[model samples]
Target: MLWFPTLSKSGFRSFIADNDEGSTGKWMVPIPVPDIGLIWEEIEDAAVEGRILAAKKSTHELVRIIGHNLACVYCSASDPDTVAETLRTLREIGVDGELKYKSDLATFDGREEYLYSSSEFETLLPRP
Candidate 1:
């Protein structure tokens, strides 16, 4: 995997134009959106159907990712059990949400996968 500190459409074009498929099995372009978290009100006390809706609403982005890539987003109030339920529910509805302990990443397309980073010191660079 090639992690670019910054990328642009032209940069992506340059990447695709490169002739080094042997070096990089796949390329991943990360798009990080800030200040967005899935909040589920009364998810624990809700019924199965309610939890389904809660899970779907909370993890809707997992299914909507475009292209061959993954996404790492934050979900508020995501306990282990809740996260498990969300993953299960997402699978039931034909979506994929994975849980990496000491981690936080999810992939929609099957091409490239990125594990959630467990780093405290991180930076988000601009991309276009």
Candidate 2:
């Protein structure tokens, strides 16, 4: 199973794009994770740069550190209670933001599809 870290649009683009640091330091580029096992090491590496920290610490500490910029979408592969724990921790820390779940729409024949489920969808779609 793969887990995608939910980040802001800019952060997501930055995470996927290649960058060069000019002549000051070596260019640090993000690499795609081919396997889930590499996630921990990658998180540790990012933590060193202060981008994010591992959640091995207390929930309170982790919540305080994560703040309100974004909340990681608890992956389906994680324990069922993981999302609840994260939400509880976030609430305890008084953080503002939503904990989202991964979802998709697909046809029975395996074709991928995208459809708006919100009330805005009705307003946006042309009336037949």
State which candidate has the highest lDDT: 2
What TM value does model 1 have? 0.24
Per-residue CA lDDT of candidate 1, range 71-104, in tens? 2222222334433443444333333222331222
Task: Report how far off residue 8 is in candidate 2 (Å).
Answer: 19
- lDDT, candidate 2, equals 0.27
* Top-TM-score structure, candidate number: 1
lDDT of 2 by residue, 1-128 (tens): 12234322223211111211110111111222332334334433443443432222123334345431222322122222333343343333333332332221122224343221123222332333
* TM-score between model 2 and native: 0.23
Error of 1 at 120 (Å): 24
Q: Give me the displacement of residue 50 in model 2, in angstroms.
A: 15
Q: How accurate locally, in lDDT, is each candidate?
A: 0.27, 0.27
Q: Residue 77 in model 2: shift from native, Å?
A: 4.6
For model 1, the stretches where C-alpha displacement exceeds 4 angstroms are 1-67, 72-74, 96-128
Question: Whole-model lDDT, candidate 1?
Answer: 0.27
Model 2 residue-pair collision total: 0
